[model samples]
Target: MTTDGCVFCRIAARELDASVVLESATVLAFLDADPVTPGHVLVVPRAHLPTLADLDEDIAAEMFLVARSVAGALRQSSLRCDGVNLFYADG
Candidate 1:
């Protein structure tokens, strides 16, 4: 979907409240309010791109870089983390 009025966009724009963990010029990472597990986060690009294929290379790279950093932080946290799983959902 387009970024206009999108919930993610709102979060990125700071119009919505989110427990943000990491943010860069191109990406935003925040805690999922209804997390399936503790520390669960949703990392997204500031620009609205419906699917991975739609994302420009640079933005996609930045998004994954942020995701990696988040996972690393999670692994280093006090939580009993066994491993990290990454999932991408587009709808």
Candidate 2:
């Protein structure tokens, strides 16, 4: 399910544009349009959930897995960062 006017839902639905880095059945990882760092990304469930409490455990796990993979790629890429940080935000 999805919420009307949800930016993430729009991104997941391909109604909006995002520099997607990773995508799976349950999650989508994309570059942050307004980023703290060059490689900053947002990992989100494809479903629209208002908060973390509303997220399914399986989907949450997948989100992290996707985040991990993205982080590793960022570290190994031309960005040449020694490490990566993952942040979770709910809106």
Worst 10 residues of 1 by lDDT: 1-10
Over 4 Å off, model 2: none
Clashes of each: 0, 0
In candidate 1 the C-alpha lDDT for residue 43 amounts to 96
Which candidate achieves the best lDDT against the true structure?
A: 1
- Tens-digit per-residue lDDT, 20-77, candidate 2: 9999998999999998888989998888876888888898899889999998899889
Each candidate's TM vs. the true structure? 0.92, 0.92
Report every candidate's CA lDDT. Answer: 0.90, 0.88
Model 1, total clashes: 0
Worst 10 residues of 2 by lDDT: 82-91
